[model samples]
Target: MWVERYGPKNIKDMVGNEETRISFLNWLKDWKKGSKPAILIGPPGTGKTTLVHLAADELGYNLIELNASDVRTKDKMTQKLGPTLSTHSLFNGKSLIFLDEVDGMYYRQDRGGIEFVQELIDSGRVPLVMAANIEDDKKVIKLIRKSKVFRFRRVVPRLVELYIEDILKKDVAKLSKESIRLIVREAKGDMRAAINTAQSLAGLSTEELSSVVSSRNLAYSLKESFEAFFNADSQEEAYKALIASKVPPRDKVKIAYLSVINSGLKGDTLIKALEKIGEADKIVNMIGTTQEWRLLRYLDRLLAYSLFNTLPKGSVSYSEEDMPWNLKVRMWNEGKVLKDIGGRLSKFLHISSREAVSIFMPYLLVVIGKEKKSLERFIRLLGLGESALKVMVKESERVFLKVR
Candidate 1:
C-alpha cells in the first residue's frame, strides 16, 4: 500500500503537525525515570504512530511497541511489560514503551489494563509513550490526566497535496491538476488516503479520471449518507444519495433503520417506514445468504423511494448518531471476543461457532450473569480473565433486561 511505501522514515521527514512533533521529540530528549508518559492523540492516517517510531529511532531508544490487538488482561500486561519497566536494555540503551491505540481498551475486556499502565508510568524506570485516535474518550481522558498529552491535528490539504506531488514526481507519474485537486479535496486532510488515491490514479487517462473522481467524491461516510437521505428534497435526490454512498448495501439498510427509529417519526409513518426498511433488510440478507449480488441494485430504490417516502414532511430532524471512534473500535473488539466465546461454546455444545454465537451465547450469558456460581464455573472452564468475565457479565445483564 502507498501508505506504507511512502511513510515517513524520520521525525524531520514527517509532514504537518511540526509543533506537535517537536514537542514529542523534546519530551523524549528530556525523559527521566518517573517522568510523565507522553500520549500522542489524533485521528488515524495523521502520522501520530509514524512520529513515535521515527522519534524512537532518532533518539537511540530501544522501542517496545504494543498495539490494541495485544491481550491486555492484568496478568498478560504485567508479564509482558513488567521487565521493561524495571530493567535497562540488554545492550545498555534506553528503552521506550510505546502503546498504540490505547483508546481501544473496552472497560469490560481491558479491566485494570489502564490502571496497571498508569502505575508503571508513575514510577517506572523506562520512558513511556502512547498513541490514540481520540482525546475525548473516557479511557483516553484518564490517560491524559497522568501524561503529557500532545495532540496531532489532521494534516491540512495543502500539505497533503505537496506530499502527494513529491511522491508523484519520484514515481515519474502524472495527473491533471484538476485530478490532484479533487483527490486532495476528497481526502479531507487524511494524508494516507490522499496518497493511496493518487497511487491508484497514477496511470489512468485524464478522460477516465473524471468519472473515478466523481465516484470517489460522492463517497459519503455512513453518517453523512444517512443525513443526506433523510434531508433530500426529492425521490431522485434521495436515490442518488444512497447510490453515491460507499457503505455496503447490507449496512446501508441498517443505517436507514437506525435513522428512522431514532428520527421520532411516529404512528402511520413509523409503521410504513419500518415496513419498507425491513423489506430492504430482507433483500440484503438474501443477497448475503445466496451470494446473489445482482439483487443489490434494488436496495437503492427501496431505501430511497420506498422507505424515505414515509418521512413526515417539512424539516424532519434528528441528532447525528454518536458513532465515535472509540465506540467503533470497541465494537470491532467485541466482535472478536464474541467469536472467541462462540468457539468455546461450540466445542462444549457440539455445534458450530455461528450457531453458538447467534443461538446460544445470548441466553448463556443471561444465565451466567444471573447465577454467580455459573459465571465462576464458566470463567474457570473457559480460562477467561477478569476483563472477559466482566464483558460477559455486562452483556448478559443487557440480554436479561431485554428479555424481561
Candidate 2:
C-alpha cells in the first residue's frame, strides 16, 4: 500500500532514471501518428509503469492501460485495443496505450498477441507504451524490433534510502540509520520493496526490529527454493524444504519445470521429470478451478518427491519470477475502481455487472461524451457527484474518439 500511497504524482516527482524519464517524455511529446511505439524495459520496482501513467496524466493524454493478467488472446487484444489505436481522441487530447509486462506472454496463453501488437504499432494513430522486465526474451526481442526501447536501471541504494526517509517523515515514523541502511541493502535496489520493508519496521522496538529484519532476510528466495528441492538428500528433506518455501505452489511448479530443462537431465530422466511437472501443473490448475485449497498441501510433495527426485543432486539457481509489489498494488487499486464502476453502471442499467463492463460501458461512454444533456441526466440519475462526473466525461472523451 505504501508503494501506491507514495507513488510519484507526476513525471518530475519520479526518483532515479532522470535522464531516461526525460527521454520518455520527449518521445511522447514528439510522437506523431504511426510513430514507433516505445518499450520501457527494466527490472521490477524501477517505476516503468509509473512513468507511463504519470507522463500521460501530466501531458493531458487519456491513458488506456492493459496488463499481462488481462486476456491476451489475439481476439481479446484486437477487441479491446484495436479501436483505441486507430482513432483520435474526441476531446482532442492524445491517448496513450500502456501494456505492462509484455514479456509474460507465451505462445499458448497469448497466441498472436505479439503479432497483433506489432500490427498496431505499425499503423496506430497514438503512441503505444509497453513495459517488460526481460528485454531479451524472444517475444520481447520481436517487440523491440518495432519499438523505441528504453532500458530503466535499478534505483541506487542511496536514492532508495532517501525516498524511504521522505515517506517515513511524512508518516511521522522514526527508524534508526542502521535499520534504514539494512532495509535498503536488503531490498537490492528495489524501491517498492524498501518502502514496504520500512512500513513493516515502523513502530517496532529496536529489539524486535533486528529480529524482524533477520527473519525477512532468511525468507526463501526462488533460487534457494530450487536448490533446496534439487539438493535434498532425502524425501523428508525435500518435503520440509518445499513446505517451508515462500514461493507459491504455482510458481514452484514453473521453477521446477525450468530447472529440469536447464539442468540437462537427458533421455528418461528428462522425460520423467517433465511428466511429473506436468502432473503438478494439472493439480495447480485444478486447485485454481475448484478452490479446493486442501489440494495445495499435496502440491509440495508431488513437486518434491516426484519431480525434484528426477533431478541430479545439486543446487539450481534461477532468477526470481514473482510479480513486483508495485504492479500488484497498482492492479489491486485498478481492480477495485473497475468493480465499483461496474457495480454502479450495472445497477443503473438493470444488467449484470459483467455485462455493464464488457458490453454497455463502451457505448455508454461514447453517448455520454457526444450528448451533454444525456450526460447531465445520467449524472443526476446515478447520483454521480461533480468530480465523478468530470472523470466520466474525461474517460468518455477517449471512448468517443474510438467510436467516432
Candidate 3:
C-alpha cells in the first residue's frame, strides 16, 4: 500500500526521469481536439499509474480508469466509454479516461485488443491515458506508432529512502536509522517496495536495522536460497523459505538439484535429489493440468528434500568450469518468465497455464531472430528475464546453430 500512500502525488513529488515527466506534461496540454491517447510505459512500480493520476489531478481533470480485467468488448468500448469520453468538458467539466495495464487483457489476441484502442484513438472523443509496463516491440507495431509514449524509470535508492523515512517519522515515530537503512536497501530501487520493506521489518523486529550500504544479494542470490534450503541444518528453516520462495518445485528441484550437484552431490544422493524434484514436478504438472488439489502433498516433499535430506553429495568445488554469471542470471530470469507466461497466456486464452506453457514455450525457446524478438517482447511485457527459458525444443523453421 506504500504505492498507494506515497506514490508521487502531483507529478513533481515523483523522483527521477525529469524528461519523461516533462514530455507527459506537454502531451497533457494538447491531448484533446484529435490527438491520440497518451501511453505511459515503464517497469512495474515505476509510478506509471501515479504519474497519470498526478497529471490528471494537476491539470484539474476527472479520471475514469479501466484495467484489462474490465470487459473491454468492442461493444463496451464503442457504446459505453466512447460517448462521454469526448463530449465531456474537463474535471467535473474536464474528464480523462484512463486505461491501466492495457496489455493485461484476457481476450484472444484477435479479439480487437490493440485494434480496439486504435479505433478509440481514431474516434478522438476524449483525451485518454494508458499505463502499461511495455514498449513497442515487433508484436505490437501499430500501438507503438499511434500513441505518444512516455517512459518512467525506477526511483533511486537515496530519494526512496528519504521518502520512506519522512513518512515513517510521521506514521511511527521510533524507527531506528539502522532499520531505515535495511528498508531502503531491500527496496531495490522500488519506492513502494522500500516502504513495504520498512513496514515489514518494523513489525517484526525493533532492532536498529543496518547494512544498507553493505554488499547485498548478488546477481546469483536466488541460488543462495537454494543452498540454504537443501543444505540447511534444520527442516524448519528450509520448509519456511521454500514454501515462501517464488520458485515452484520444478525449478526449486532444478535449482536445489543444480546447487546440490555443484556441491559435488552424486550417486544415490544425486539420484535422491533428482527423485525429489521429479516427484515435485509430477504433482506440479497435475496441479497445472488436472487441477488435482490432492497433489499438494508433493510440494511439501520437495521442501523435505531440501530440509530432511542428509549429508549432501559432492564436495563443493570452485574451479571446475563453474556456471557463468550471465548464464545463471539468464536462467533465473527465464524460469520466472516461462512460468508466468504459462499462467498468464493461458488465462488470456481461457486455457490452463500448464497447457499454455507446454504449447508456446517450446516454440519461443527454439526459434531465433525475429521469432525470438517477438517472444522476448512478450517476456518483457510480463516483466520476466532469465535462463530457465531453454532452447530445449527444435523448431521446424530453421536449424539452430549450437553454441558452446
**Candidate 1 lDDT by residue in tens digits, 66-168:** 7899888778888887776555645466888888899997767888887877787777578888899988899899889888999988899899889988888
User: Residue 119 in candidate 3 has what lDDT?
Assistant: 71
Models ranked on lDDT: 1, 2, 3
Q: In candidate 3, where is summed lDDT lowest over 10 consecutive residues?
A: 388-397
What's the residue-level lDDT of 143 in candidate 2?
88
Rate residue 309 of model 2 by lDDT.
69
lDDT of 3 by residue, 1-404 (tens): 65566555667777767789888888987666688778787877667777778888888877887776777766666666765764565433677888788767545742665567777778777787877776655423456577787878777878877787777766664566666766666666776677677666555533333333232322223555555555555667666546645544466655654554556565886676567666666667878798776766557555565425654522432222246455677677656655776776676778788777777655555553346556556656655554322322222133344321
Once superposed on the true structure, which residue ranges of model 2 sit more than 4 Å away at CA? 89-91, 214-404
Model 2, CA-based lDDT: 0.80
**TM-score for all predictions?**
0.56, 0.54, 0.52
Give the poorly placed runs of model 1, Cα more than 4 Å off: 89-92, 203-208, 217-404
Which prediction has more favorable TM-score, 2 or 3?
Answer: 2
> What are the lDDT scores of the predictions, listed in order?
0.81, 0.80, 0.63
- State how far residue 214 of model 1 sits from its true place (Å): 3.8
| Alpha-carbon RMSD of each model | 12.4, 21.1, 12.5
lDDT of 2 at 324: 41
Order the numbered candidates by TM-score, best leading. 1, 2, 3
